[model samples]
Target: MATIGRFVVSVVGAGEGHNGRRTAAVARALAFISALIAFAIAGLMIFDAVRVVNEPIEPDQVDFRLVTGVMLVIMAAIVAPLGVLNLIGARLLGRRKPRGRTSVLTGSLLGAVVAFMVGADAPVVVWVSVIVLFIVTAVAAALPGTKRWVRGAPSPSESGELVLGGVG
Candidate 1:
């Protein structure tokens, strides 16, 4: 049933119509590149995290667990709230629009790149996950007619950057 519906929507140009399909194509291309970086970083972080947890620590050095544990907690705290909001924004897509969230996500993504380049200590995986999700969240949150979507007041969707209003 869902497949049938999707087919119908696809025929009719549901999301972006042909543009959406094209966007998907481009997104996939981008994702192919991004997912590699993401997975590689994640793999490295996992190694670091596991090492921190199981490795013996010197009496003079800070406990890796303490640091990693702190990182996980902090990551959870930050991601959880945004996750909820992103979910809500997702639900609102096509129902009511808000300013675009993509910019926020884009910023976070850039930040993530910088963060990873900056250091390897702590859990980089969590941060990368959040930023990736931030990109997703921002894009999702900007879906047309979503409460959180921000394209600015428009007579039409023809031209303009998706924008994020002041509030999330």
Candidate 2:
């Protein structure tokens, strides 16, 4: 019974190391670049908001700018932390840690929500690009090899398990 249980555990375990060195390298690069871009955009939005607020304008225009600035502030709040998390994740990947799935997921979901909320007001191309970027980043973080590396587990085929001692 114990042997059978052990076999079951091994068989049911998830596979690892599906990603080659090149793939992992690409993912790391993408994650890092995405993080930097996110942070930069957030900073720019903050600056724009501040500039809009500081500009002298009529009361009616002020109300519209205030609303836009507030929305930009909210977007920055969502994006800045995500950028930090992605940066940490990228560092971990560089160190062969690969432990950033949660951060990736969170960032992806938040980005999707933000895109959906603001996409209606933006051009179609901009909306599509944002959606695609979010998807690609999320997928890169959840790749099979990435998960295996993050969990520090060996691939199933490399575990040296065989059915019935190679006689089955």
Cα lDDT tens digits for candidate 2, 13-130: 3234343444445556766776776787689779989997787887664367788789889888877776787777777766556455666656665666666675576689877777
Model 1 local distance difference test score = 0.43
CA lDDT, every prediction?
0.43, 0.66
Q: lDDT tens string, model 1, 1-168?
A: 999988755543345524333333222233333434444544555565566677787899776696885564444344333333333333332222332134233433553554454334547776566456536534432333222123332433333445466322
The alpha-carbon root-mean-square deviation between model 2 and the true structure, to one decimal in Å, is 12.7
TM-score of each: 0.34, 0.66
